[model samples]
Target: MVPASTSDPVPAPSPRPQQEDRDRSSRRRQRSAVILSAACWVSVVAAVVVFLGSGKPAQVTDVAGAITAAGIVTGLVGTDLLLLMLVLAARIPWVDRTFGPDVTMNLHRRLGKPAVYLILGHGALLTVGYSLRDGLSLWHQTLSIYSGGDMLLALLGSCLLVLVVVTSLVAVRRALAYEAWHAIHLVSYAAILVALPHQFSAGRVLAETSPQGVYWICLHIFAFGSIAWFRVAAPLFATDAHQLRVARVETLGPDVFSIHLSGRDLSRLHVRGGQYAIWRFWSRGTWWHAHPISFSAVPTDTGIRVTVRASGAGTRRLAGLRPGTRVSFAGPYGVFTAATRTAPRLAIVAGGIGITPVRALLEDRDLGPGETTVILRATDRSHAFLWDEVRALVRAQGGTVIEMLGGRAAGAPSWMSAAAAHGQATIHSLLPDLHASDLFVCGPAAWTRLVVHDARAAGLPDGRIHVENFTG
Candidate 1:
């Protein structure tokens, strides 16, 4: 185990207030998750109820009738899932505050394919069912259906949904540029709109004058309204009001640099240390791409800082940004902060460039002396960009900073340096009081998972372990 560096180890103040705050935050997050999840399931169940109550189920007499009934049910549930997916992607304040943007996006991704599959099932089942009922072939039935009514629009919507889901697959997504992928994703809105006409006009259960029709209309309004306000209007308003611009760019290492931004009343953004913002640098070279980057330092009255590693074409262009380049941003988002702390003492594990947020968290004025133990990891000294800054901050707080330097081991417990792996170092060995401390880990996704696994194996409760991966 690496030795801790502390000038003077003193006992911390009573954490009664902090504990109470954590308790409140935990309750709030839990309540939000429960309410949102229940609402989604209720919507799905309500869709099924509307279908059954409309006398659609009783009309089934043959195999063809059964297939048609199944198609109707699938359509209702699939549309509901689509609306829910839209809401999750809306980035509403309550949702972001509770689960953070990463969790929200992850949920959004998980729902996409299933929603598309159900929609496709609805289409295929209806085609076969109708064709069989009319004693016609599937191809002839499809041609007849698409030749009239809103079926063509429905077909177009289904195709768009398929395209969106296909592009989202891991291999396909990795092959496309972010900008191209995002543009394709935005096509989902058009898909939803085009698919709506057939649901209200062609479908019996949700006909214009039906009660279920009103409910479906309200659902659309709610989903689109949230996206309109939070994802679009709010960010636009914040950009205009703040009038942020690049003050300077400072190189911290080979391909890592910090962008210092000056703005009007920056403190009003209410950005916590470990939270991030979706930023668009309005420069000729970089305005097309938006970045989700963490704050490397706490905001002052008129300024804030975000550090970025030039890992891709978009970020590499950021390194060339000149002073006075305008910036527009979406948020001060995330839950990986001091506010999420549940224990009196803190154990922070940060690797590579993930140290940016950890650096900012350490600078929090609320941090008490001897209340933190930080472990910073890197492949080599050159990769440890903010080590000195972290060390200084921890030292001033009367806390300890343990540096884990060297190439990672080629085998099991691969998150640690080869030397530490050889010496059999583990999470419990590095942070002896880990059970009593909130373990905040941020790093590469795979490495972060390993650290979290070790923390859990050491019997630390799941709630006490917070993670933010630097996969971006």
Candidate 2:
């Protein structure tokens, strides 16, 4: 009798707690948005009431004129703040290791452009209005005393707006580097802090005469304060107290290395396969700086393993590190997990060093069987990182590994035909019927774009193709 296969049947993927957390957070943001939007309309109505009630001509000195100006400026700024908060809450990391960085980053770009426009309007109107009211120069006018500390508060608000715009631009951001850009963006909290004083002190609607105005003001404070506490403070407090210490380090290839880190309560760490953590080596002496890296090894009884390929300054340092080094991690963040959808067949495609996340998925006992396929495309055979390990894992899982050696892999037409052939022995061949399958592709921006385009040309549905790019 044929020996019973020792390999366990592939387990069904489970729901990720992080996705649930994100859903909950999205609901809260929607509710907040509704309330804020209603309050904005209410403020508009109040401004109209103040304007119609006044019999005086619409001169700059008139109370109606001032009220109208203030209302427009406040509404613009408040709305922008609400939108930005909602975007930030969605938590799209440009180069997120999990969730195939491409999708998340595209959404971020779409939202960012509108936010910049709103911020510009808020700054321009307020500056001109103040300059006209006070007889001083534009800069000096913002400094002049107003009935309720509005001018001083406005000045501080302007400073924050300047910082946000400067750091958000791509050119300035690249020069500052990722670490520096993140640090500068943190000042957004300070901007919100300064704006609060101006809103409370100068807001005419918030005065005792308008009870509804006070309600709106209170709502803004509650929404902003809650976001700050949860997004910033909670993470700092909740991470493990005893940082991870590197137990072992091994260079697998020219640029690839496996780093094993162990710390207290390793089992309870609750990190998922295909997810990444932000690592900060203590030797760097900069706790604020951290780089996102994919977890390489399957979580074992001892510790966690992250595979790194030297790419930049921070990663180069990591590749050179010895064993027994201590490091701090901020997360097990990213939505790139097997739990997102269910399918009869799964295909994983990785280009260059993008194989890191795919490797983790291969190790998962939950994703094996004849239903899965792992495809890796590298520039050349010599540059094919993780070739041996990937091949072994694929065979063990009853899956196939497709390695396409670019540049010189025989004639183009023949090579393409061979790579697309179907059989048990020809692992590089593409599966013919791929309509109902799920495909996960991760790589540099250009490679991911090409793969996605080809997959679509091959009759793959848009929903079935998930592309993750690290560059964006």
Which structure among the candidates has the greatest lDDT?
1
Off by over 4 Å in 2: 1-113, 123-150, 204-234, 241-243, 285-288, 408-431
The stretch of ten residues in a row with the least summed lDDT in candidate 1 is 1-10
Residue pairs with colliding backbones in model 2 are 94-472, 99-336, 100-468
Task: Give me the candidate number with maximum TM-score.
Answer: 1
The global C-alpha lDDT for each of the candidates, from Candidate 1 onward, is 0.87, 0.59
* TM-score against native, each model: 0.95, 0.72
- Model 2 clash count equals 3
Q: Model 1 over residues 361-404: C-alpha lDDT tens digits?
A: 88874667677889898888888887888889988878878888
Q: 1-472 in candidate 2: lDDT tens per residue?
A: 1111223334433444544654565465456556644654565465445433443224557543674466454444454444345434434332233233444345444454454555456555555665665555767644454324665665566567567667888788878877777777666556655665655565443443454455445655655755555455644554455457888777877777888887766656566667787777666533445778888755764578888777776676776565667687656666556644334567877877788777776676454356566667666666676677777787776765666655422443222223232222121235433564678888777767766777777778775776656652
What is candidate 2's CA lDDT for residue 379?
62
lDDT of 2 at 144: 52
Evaluated against the true structure, the overall lDDT of model 1 is 0.87
Q: lDDT (0-100) at residue 409 of candidate 1?
A: 73
